[model samples]
Target: MSLTAVETLNREFLEIRCRILDLAAMLDRLERSDDTVADDPRLKRIHEAIDLLTKSASRNSSSDRAEQVQLTFSRPYDSAWLQNLKVRPR
Candidate 1:
């Protein structure tokens, strides 16, 4: 766990948090739109998925803090090797 790894992990976590917030805002916008609510099943499904993701993220974050667990990033460089790399706090 090097400094670089820690920085990267922090960046990734921030990015994920931002994405969750953005999805929530998007869902709010969709719900408030003037279009027929029943017209698009896809939007409904997407909203449901986003809700699930938001809940999961919230749960994970709370548990992580309680247990002092640190989130890390798995390397995406190798297509075949799935378990070779991890980035965590030093």
Candidate 2:
């Protein structure tokens, strides 16, 4: 017999999780390399989008998190400061 709705969803969830883990590992390797092509607009946008997505995911998860965290930031910052945002060269 074919899988039920729940089974299909569960399979997809696992697949997505595995893909995310693989992506994470690749990104980790890229982080160590100095040959990053920051000049590529597509790469730039992808990096920005992923950063936002990760922060959004973290914020949502943190809300229901058991261990409370009170993050403080300087002027012109809020919950966004709670995220580990990229630090551009100053």
Write the residue-wise lDDT of candidate 1 on 1-90 in tens digits. Answer: 556857878869888789879977977887788885666766655655555555767776443431221221222357544345554435
lDDT winner: 2
Candidates in order, TM-scores: namely: 0.41, 0.40
lDDT of 1 at 19: 80
- Full-model lDDT, candidate 1: 0.59
Model 1 quality (TM-score)? 0.41
lDDT of 2 by residue, 1-90 (tens): 999969987879988789889978977887788888668765565566566556767777544322221121114445565454755545
Q: Which residues of candidate 1, in runs, are more than 4 Å off?
A: 1-9, 51-90
Q: What is the C-alpha lDDT of each candidate?
A: 0.59, 0.62
Q: Which segments of candidate 2 are over 4 A away from where they belong? A: 1-6, 48-90
